[model samples]
Target chain A: MSLSKQHELHTRRYGRNVGVGLLLVGVIAIVFGLTVVKVTRGDYETPATTTVQE
Target chain B: MTDTSFNSQTGTYQTEATFGDYFALLKPRVMTLVVFTAFVGLLAAPTPVHPFIGFCAILFIAIGGGASGALNMWWDADIDAVMKRTQRRPIPAGKVTGDEAFAIGMALSAFSVVFLGLATNWFAAGLLAFTIFFYVVVYTMWLKRWTPQNIVIGGAAGAFPPMIGWAVATGGVSVESVLMFCLTFMWTPPHFWALALFMRKDYDNADVPMLTVTHGRRATRVHILVYTILLAILAVAAGFTSIGGPIYLSVAVVLNVLFLRGAWQIWRRDEDMSEADNFLTERKFFKLSLLYLFAHFGAILVEAGLDKLGWGLWA
Candidate 1:
């Protein structure tokens, strides 16, 4: 293959791979975000600072 | 071992690994567990750490965990390359250089330990340093390649985060902290051996002396059953401590029953039968196993919350 053709091929491959990776990441983030929302349900308080004392 | 695509061609398709590739070398999933357990340790302590300082301490410890993972990847790239599960790792897949991985790991190690010591206390820093050493030297370098008992002894690295967290808060270890350590430690063998039972080929190909390879699958099954019994005892004991309450006890009771039943079923399996048929059961246990640790520590936090409101059982 010609130099320009090889370069084009590499660019196309890289773009495709990056697109797939980003899609996977996006899906994961969405699922994770929804799960956190469901679990916390806006009832999230900062962790308490005091230890239990008798 | 240059490939034909690179060396044979005048115009080669040579690619260099990027910065993100190096970061990917760290086992982030494992790091999450370290962070959660450490947070529990910090929260459960008798003494309270300043919120800002505690956050920073746990952050440094997590970075320390990532550093250990990077170093492990660097060292184990050879074996990792051969194993199907680890073949896509940055170093083995030609996405990161071994030297680059080593440098990142070492730099992070120094930064994490020193800053942790300054931010929290020397005891926490010392524990972090030893954890990195144990994982790198004892587990990755020495035990993993040499023995079937690798995960058992090496499990200590994963178990130490809670102790370190406790030290960060209390400046010393306590029964509660040790129980947390024991819980993770005992849980490791069974968790990993299940993976080994399924992924036997990976260990065999790598020539790693995993229990499945060194001992037969039957032996591994029996060991899992035995360890599950021991782990159950340790886990249930934690429910009776100051950290435990009705919520924790309830969770523990349900978790143990399910876990013990899973083990019992596994022990009952004949070597001739395909694990594939009952793989769902084992996979369910694995999923629950993750929740098991998280829920236990989460319950500890709940107990702490209750104590603050004067409703804690221990109180």
Candidate 2:
């Protein structure tokens, strides 16, 4: 293969790896953002006890 | 190694870096400890973290730990080149450049910290950032070459992960988290010292001021005993904390006894003993030290699990 072609192929491969890594990061970030929202809004808080009267 | 190719067009040397090389820069083994301890800390916290949040926290903390390892490798490349144990590391072995390692470390450090802050809380992120700084700056750059007490003081960096995990769950620190941190912190000196005892020549050749190199093997042995005694006290005492219970206490007691016996064996050795024999005792102690921390943390994890089941001792 020509030097330019090899260089181009390398560049494309590198870009692909970075793209995948960034995609994973994006997904994790979204999950984290949702969790943060849920936490800050007290979604995980314990429910108040309701006593039953006979 | 750097695979250089003749660029018939530009005629410049270009380094061919690989995925494994980059991964090696992260020091995955150390990252494992950081991740596991942090996971335990998060689970053992009073408030439960959302599953997704917990996973994100551990992932980011591991990244932070890896970043620190890369930065450490970057700075310690010189000593690493001299030492037998680290001579084949990416940088020293000519696989990765110092600049490349530094850039990766800095980028990952910033990425992990920022994303962790967004994922969990700024408190945990801050602790992660401090951990990176302490490992890279305090331990690698400043202390490792300058003082025999490097591991003693610098162990705090390794000790912070569990606390950060706890912070991820509660957005604050507590006595439980502090005790967990103490467990790792106190365990650090003797662990490294035992390894140093066996690998004394590595520090000597590198001219790093490890206690073994600075104070002689006898003094190092004395230090090990002293630290192990102190560690035994701390490790067992940690069992009584809120994070600890019958399971943790039982594990801690047995592990500390074995650990103390190992330290005593090392302490009792005299100069007349063969290097091979000394190496055996030190190597055994070193191996046990690894299990000592893991079992302690594992026991804490079991206690946390039992707590969730309403079967914990305190429950």
Candidate 3:
């Protein structure tokens, strides 16, 4: 292959690498984000309030 | 019929290796240190990360370190072939092509940084990205061929892993992170110079301008001693911080004293002596250098444990 063609191929390969990397990151992020949202929400109710004599 | 033709033909076959061959290209020993130190950084941070995020951060950092090694091997193939220590490395030995190594490195580098950023935070991911770039582009491609100071500046790339780990948890830099960086940065010159002193012939044959090659063995000896003093000071100082405690202080004191003594032995030697005498000193110091960093980082983990137990001396 010509040097330019070789360079082009490598560049394309690098792009593919980046794409895979992004996909992995996206998968991780979705799971993490969902967990964070759930944790922060009012899904777990506060303990029932107890009255004390003044 | 000519040597050039034979060389070109061999180059064509350099990519023929199986899975194990590529695995060897990652420089596993260095990766181990990177992973350990980065893990320590993550654990030592004031803020806590979800366990899963923490694990992913460390995994990405290890991959980033491996990526740097792969890229370094890709760029340094010529010198690697000439050096006895590196001659059997995948690229140098024709087990992998430069293109293949480059591809693997670039791929891993991207994967490590981007995923780490997403799984944890962008700050850590950005640091990983820069570390890969600095090691490959700045250190390997530009500096290695051009200057004797390559390792000194390039050392920052290696030092950044722990800092990246710190960022993963805290999402920013702090005094503790800087201290961690200083420990590795200061440790590097002496660690590498000792090896250079012993492997002067390799550098010379490869025409790489290591300190020993450019300034003579005496200068390299003095340089090692100087860096060792600096490293000792930094190591002990680290023991006084929030990250430090009785365990780390004790570990640092013992390791630093032994390291200084080793450096003194290396410095005391005359260059005109036989290889049996001189090489022995360099070899011992080089081995000690590896143990030195391992112990120092291990001490940091100990300190973190003490802190968690509410029994830290420094705290």
Candidate 4:
């Protein structure tokens, strides 16, 4: 069946769905923010020992 | 995807688990203590952390605390169902089941620990992991049912958040973190025992070995008085620490005096007087205890902030 209306299940679980959706979004934002900060601060930078100096 | 419960009397499948029901699994009130103390711990440290990193650190710490709460609820579902205070919890009220609580708890526990390690440092992450384990396995599963000294020992679980917060910034433990931990650790027994003082029957009915239940309420009263005196001394002494200054000392002196007075009032009253007064003193003391803790931590946070501006301390 083609989707035409909100399913009873969907309506019943709407609040929980919204909450889960928002939480997932928050997780993504945190991960992305942490990454940008880490990279900018050179937290992931390698030590000079990683380079082979002849 | 599907969480449905069938009611035989109603002849319906009720979608009883709301977003709030799931949220309740996380004992949000306890998480507030975790968040506040951890935030204070992080800020109170000598080292400065990046704002975003600090925020993530607190968030992960709170999630770890909430995860442990869920686990505690799962383990205590039986006792919680019987206890009036805890009867409305998600599991006991039948809003969520034990298995679901356990799964969410485990998932969040692992997620929080891994994220904390990445976001801050592995030392804090490991402390968070130990806190979750201590609250769940040591406190909930083992100590809670087995000992009348449950709150004394299990209180350590609640006290770990600040230390974890300090760890988030300093990447190691120190005297200040230990002091903060001890403040909460010492405070827990009297705070909870006063609760047990007034709400005596709940523990007796639930068969949890509260000091009021195992010892007589008379003994519990003496215990409260003793612990409070010790707490007051510790509270005032902590004011001289590096975390403290003029404002902190003032807050400490005033609140500790008040807290000692409340504890003394509790000790002096007999049960007959207590029942006649409807536990007014115990209830008032309980209320003050909340303010007592928050104000102490708030003073610490203020000191930390002022220190940043080079105007923090009395000395």
How do the candidates score on chain B by TM-score? 0.93, 0.95, 0.95, 0.96
Work out the iRMS of candidate 4: 0.4
- Candidate 1 clashing pairs, residues 3+ apart or interchain: none
Best by DockQ: 4
Q: Can you rank all candidates by lDDT, best first?
A: 4, 2, 3, 1
Better model by DockQ: candidate 2 vs candidate 4: 4
Candidate number of the best lDDT = 4
Task: Estimate TM-scores for all models.
Answer: 0.81, 0.87, 0.83, 0.95
Q: What TM-score does model 4 score on chain A?
A: 0.78
What is each predicted model's overall lDDT from 0 to 1? 0.82, 0.87, 0.84, 0.92
Model 4: per-residue Cα lDDT at residue B6:
66
Deviation of model 2 at B145, angstroms: 1.2
Residue B253 lDDT (model 2):
92
Misplaced by over 4 Å in model 1 are A1-54, B1-14, B275-278
Q: Is candidate 1 or candidate 3 better by lDDT?
A: 3
Q: Candidate 3, residues B1-315: lDDT per residue as tens digits?
A: 211212362353443455567777789989998999999999988887777668777878998899899989988888888899998898877867788899999888988887787677788898999999998899989988788898899899889988999999999999999999999998898989888887768989999989888888888889889989988998898888888888898999999999999999889887665276758878988899899898888888888877887777787
Residue A52 deviation, candidate 1, in Å?
44
Residue pair clashes in candidate 2: none
Candidate 2 global TM-score: 0.87
Candidate 4 segments whose C-alpha is farther than 4 A from its true place: A1-5, A49-54, B1-15
Error of 1 at B300 (Å): 1.5
Clashes of each: 0, 0, 0, 0
